[model samples]
Target: MDFVSELAVARYEKIGEIVGKCVEKIEKPRTFSDVIDTVVTDKYVGIPIFLSLMWAVFQFGYSISVPFSDAIDVFFAWCAGIASRIENPYLASFLSDGFFGGWGFVLVFLPPIAFVFIALTILEQTGYLPRAAFVVDRAMTRVGLQGKSFIPMLLGFGCNVPAIMATRTIDDEADRKITIMVNPLMSCSARLPVYVLFAGAFFKESAGAVITLMYVLGIILAAVMATLFRKFIFGGSPSPLLMELPPYEVPTIKSALMSSWLRIQIFLKKAATILFIGAVIMWFLATHPWDATNGGELIENSYASMIGHAVEPIISPLGLDWTAGVALVGGFLAKEIVIGTLAMIYGVGEEGVADVITQHFTPASALALMTITLIYVPCLATLGVVRQELGSWKWTGLVLAYELILAYIVALIVYAVASVVML
Candidate 1:
């Protein structure tokens, strides 16, 4: 019940008891909100509407931002062209191939990321995410979680680092632990580029649908894991949800855009600091031994390639080669680096990355890739916060182990099923 409704009910109940049948009970006339909540919170349609709106959010985001992304891609390629003309070979390589090439690949994703953030901000500003929590609360209880836990998980859609931190609100240690353990299952916005690149390359017309499934998959897995943890480890029932839903209102464009900007600004700050350093290290590994590899001409001889090839046997069943291993390894530092790693290793620009990916990967493996990217270990920043919040390396290690094993099994299943279906 809303705050107003609670107050009204309290006043009337106390008065009625005092009056002792002197006044007949009243059936109040409904307001506009009463009518709207009837459908929006309906048992049958509520969850489906939630899913449909999520689909629309991505549809609006990825489709609407294509022009801006294309423009950014063109600009980066031009910058790389200029960077290539430097007098010194090593400096030229670092500037063009390393900086402009890799940075451009990652930056090409900004427009769609911005649009997705904007859409989520609008949903938040309009007060629907709380209603979404209400709709899913019954399902959450069955799976050993309070509906209120969904708030942090929803915030995880932006970044898991903060989302894990947000779990501080849960009073029960058991509840907080379970929520923290499963929160990484939410797909942070950093993984958007990987989804966009792979989905466009493989799923194409249904790219939006595929990306939506990634989000859905994360939510499902979080619930499933919460159930297992509750039954086996925690051994307690979920606390009942006791959250108040704020009344819905129209969000102003200025407010929505400003909030969205604040959300995406974190990425920009990290790109300049953590991401900048990681890119340099990756570049060195991918383009070293200027003598033997002929000044980074043959990436196959680079240290990164060697490491990737050593791990190839493990990932070969998923249809990814050494190159993908390299990218996945880089993703530990930051998810955004995954695309940049792929581009650098393949010697391709932002546009050519898709073409090259198609030649190298089929739809089945692409789906598997996307699935693993969704389910695999959280990024470095997220891991640090999880370690701190969990209070020890033991729990952190446990989370890592389960996620890796889960990601592998799920990706294997997806690969086998998609291969058969697509065949």
Candidate 2:
């Protein structure tokens, strides 16, 4: 037998032994009804507990990270001032605005990301994630995917690229491909800055709730879209969601913290590398011409400007202007770059654009933008993984085209309805 078969057999034997022991320990003989009652009726408690625990995690992450984020922002601002005071204007601009400002925003968000990952790691290590997956499996089945897909989908909540990679666990080719394609809709942590920034700056009292809603919406959309895809494009019977629910144990604080720190480190490195470079490039686009006055519309004259203009028409129906279009395109490279691009465009200083976004974007427009972002194309990293795992650019292209179309249609509907209601 193959490794998977062996593992499944082992798990079956283990569960059988556990059930047998339970039956023997009872004073009365246990019926089939009793087994059903134990597994089904008692499992309901896990659901609410799971949700409450998740809320606590979000609370912990936000509480722990806020002070650190503030400190980092202040330090970067001081560095920007120091650079501005230097002699050479070009070098000063590069340090203060281009490099420092561009990267500062990314660095400041690390604390919250770290906190979230740490909480998730604890959940994962304690083996509750699998139970959560089991609880949701029936709901997932209604959406035409096995319960096991839940793990990868949860991973996508952290980062879509790794989520796509996690699809390797799914043995079925078509199911795996579909999972990879839809995983990006799960709203990874990288997208949090956009939602948090926009929500906080504009809808202060409702920000947290709204951010949470957007996340929930993303999952709903993913499920709906996955169901539609399975029924039409990849017709198949739902595979049995055979999963091993490891016995629960108390999560080690040291391990949980280490896992959280590692995740934060990975996010920080990516932000410093890909996101920072993209920011500098965006800054160059906004600042070059070697003589454009500060606050001038240099974005209209630079490479980024040209690219944004090229894609603007396609995204306009979704309520995005040229600037938002540029951010969307940058998001395909890395979701975090969307904020970086916007920060560059608005000349708001790195990490300061959250405040600026609140000032500029209206409530309806912000909602529209968030909706589009929640559904748009997968990032380059995720796309590449999908291509490799599925072994076909054709499948990747199909997923890309479908996502863009869905995003546009949904965004248009949302913007129109929101506009009408708000007005």
Candidate 3:
């Protein structure tokens, strides 16, 4: 019995040694070629993982924006109150309502925008986003674009101007032009407020889903538009998508924070400069003809009111009233200014514009308006860049005309469909 027990112990020890060796081999560091081999062999899991990462990114944008946005609102309200107590009402109004409100609107969105850029930068640094482009390459090729064009499109989600500028990376001039044209359709962060506010107010249960759908719709529209342009207008063969995936590394928290801070700074500077001017202009329009009888409230009989009334007829078919028309016009300067314009026009304050819009506009109208905003002409900054890069106003004019036509057509379709279904 003693000899048999010793023999069993010896056999068990040998088996344990073999298992340890197998585990060490499995845990060995993967070589570059080894990783590529694995990726090629297991694309199913790799593709899903890529998608899951994107979903997490969108989730991060929504989650991080909430607290930061609230803080910005509080800060702006305090500033506005302090400014209102100043001696000169016009100067105070210009500082608080026009400048602060306009700039504040853009500033409040920084957290989410920064988070998105950081996440994307991390993905870029870690080499996964290129892989994403690789996975989507076939689909992009079908639409007459190289997978590399997606890099700028992804960047456009943070801001469209830089994304347009980034198109310089594309080798083919025709491909680059097409890329610049479709980058706006990727639903940049500037448009996020519209999507989030409306989705929250009207489709609370499906807010995330609805927002996701809008993003997908934007991408689909871009792909279709690119395909059509290539087939008829551009007249070029699809470019080959070629990229090398870099090895993954642990993303530094410090680097990520710095990236976020820089982005926030850029956004703030834009708010302070371009958006400040826009907001003041909007305020001048919305607030004038001092109403002494109405407790000094800025009356609608001011200069801005006259312009709103003038443009109302043209935009009313899209379900936008004169007030909405003003907002649309303001949006031409910077897409984000629409919310601020509405806030100022409705006297709802910057944070309250979404709520006021929800209260006044039906879901159908709101959706239609959102669609129009999505497909409307590029902002001044974008158009300037387009003109500079394309080297002529001809393409810029074409883009504007095409987008306006598309916006009107799409807005009408959405309105018609919603009216029939909802009724």
Per-candidate TM-scores read: 0.94, 0.86, 0.85
Per-residue C-alpha lDDT of model 2 across residues 1-423, encoded as one tens digit per residue: 999999999999999999987876547786654453355325667566666777776666666777887888888888887987879888887888787787677777777788789888998887678777877888888898888799899998898878888999998877887788789899888887777667767677777677777877888888998999899988986688887656667788998888878777778788868888877776777676756444334557666677789988887765677888878888887777787788777876655787777665777778888887888887777788878887898888887898888888877887888788878
**Candidate 1 Cα misplacement greater than 4 A, ranges:** 1-29
Tell me the lDDT of model 1 at 136.
Answer: 90
Candidate 1 positional error at 391, Å: 1.0
Q: What is the C-alpha lDDT of each candidate?
A: 0.88, 0.78, 0.77
List the candidates ranked by lDDT, beginning with the highest.
1, 2, 3
Query: Model 3: what TM-score?
Result: 0.85
Candidate 2 Cα misplacement greater than 4 A, ranges: 1-49, 292-299
Question: Candidate 1: global Cα-lDDT?
Answer: 0.88
Clashes of 3: 0
Residue-pair clashes per candidate, as listed? 0, 0, 0
Best-matching candidate per lDDT: 1
Candidate 1 matches the true fold with a TM-score of 0.94
Query: What C-alpha lDDT, on a 0 to 100 scale, does residue 297 get in candidate 2?
Result: 49
Which residue pairs clash within candidate 2?
A: none
